[model samples]
Target: MNIAEVSKKYEISADTLRYYERIGLIPEVNRNKSGIRDYTEEDCRWVEFIKCMRSAGLPIEILIEYVTLFQQGNETIEARKDLLIEQRKQLIEKMENVKKTIERLDYKIERYEQSVVTKENELKRTDD
Candidate 1:
């Protein structure tokens, strides 16, 4: 597919895709005879993987190192696994913090709602 199609399909900007390619965050994308990008299934898979990792809050520097290790062939398998495991641990911690934040927000919102209801009820009693 063309860059535009890939962009729409992946919900990413074409410029961002080019930037990923330029920065080696993704492997090189093949271009047609006209020098336009033609995304293969493998390339698309890389794009999807990068996007997913990015959405999960993985740092670009870490991803770049991961991709570099991935390109080094089979010898780096163990190292890559270790890297992923470490990143997963970080992501889990981040998720826990986010959950705590959500709970705090919920508590605050509930308090505000209760206060509003109490004031409304008090106003109604005064009007009665």
Candidate 2:
């Protein structure tokens, strides 16, 4: 597919796709004779993987390292796995923190709800 088609399909802008290619985040795309990018299935897969990793808060530097290792053939398998594992560990820590924050917010909201109910009850007593 062309750059425009790939951009629309992946929900990414063409400029971002170009930047990814330039930054080595994704492999270079094959260009047609007219100098238009033609994205193959493999290219699309790379784009999908990069998008998922980015959404999960992975940094560009880490991703570039991963991609570099990936391009170095089978010898870097362990290194790639180690990188992913470390990132996963960090992501888990972040998730735990977010969970704690959610719990605290829930508790605060419940307290406010209880206060409102108490105030309503006191108002009723005064009315009677």
Candidate 3:
């Protein structure tokens, strides 16, 4: 597939895909004779993996490191596993923080609703 096709299929912009390639976030893409990117299945898989990792809030620097490790062959398997484990820990912490914030927001919203109801009831009593 071409750059545009890969961009549409992945729901990512072509510029972003180019940037990812330039930044080494994804592996190098093969270009056609005309210098247009021709994404092979392997390239597309890397794009999908990068997109998923990015959407999960993984930092670009970490991804670059992971890609570097990946390029170094299978000997870095343990190191890659360690990196993923660390990233997972960070994501879990962020999730816990988000859960707490959601609970706080819910409580505040409930309080506001109760206040509104109490004020409405008071106005009704006064009009009676």
Candidate 4:
């Protein structure tokens, strides 16, 4: 597949893919005779994994480290696992904080609505 096809399959922009490559977040892709990117199944799989990690809010610096470790082969397996575990813990904490924020916002919105209704009722009574 080409870069465009990979981007379409992953729902990421071509610039993002290029940036990932440039930033060492992904391995260098092969090029065809025309110097265009030639993506293989392995590349596609890597892109999908990267996308999943990114969607889960993994930091780009960590991702670049992960990719570097991956390129270093099996000796870094334990280190890679540790990175993922740490990131997972952080993501979980972030999700909890977001939930708390959402709950607070919901409460505030409900209180505001109630206040509006009460004011409208008072106005109606005064007008009558």
Q: Candidate 3 lDDT, tens digit per residue, 1-128?
A: 99999999999999999999999999999999999999999999999999999999999999999999999999999999999999999999999999999999999999999999999999999999
RMSD of 1: 0.8
Q: Tally clashing residue pairs in candidate 1.
A: 0
TM-score of 1: 0.97
Error of 2 at 75 (Å): 0.8
Q: Count the backbone clashes (under 3 Å) in each candidate.
A: 0, 0, 0, 0
Model 4 pairs whose backbones collide: none
For model 1, what is the C-alpha lDDT against the true structure?
0.97
Give the residue spans of candidate 3 off by over 4 A: none
Worst 10 residues of 4 by lDDT: 40-49
Error of 3 at 75 (Å): 0.6
- lDDT order, best first, reads 2, 3, 1, 4
Worst 10 residues of 2 by lDDT: 1-10
Better-scoring candidate (lDDT), 1 or 4 = 1
Kindly provide the TM-score of model 2 when superposed on the true structure, using C-alpha atoms.
0.94
**Residue 78, candidate 4: alpha-carbon lDDT:** 100
Each prediction's TM-score versus the true structure: 0.97, 0.94, 0.97, 0.92
Candidate 1: tens digits of C-alpha lDDT, residues 35-101 = 9999999999999999999999999999999999999999999999999999999999999999999
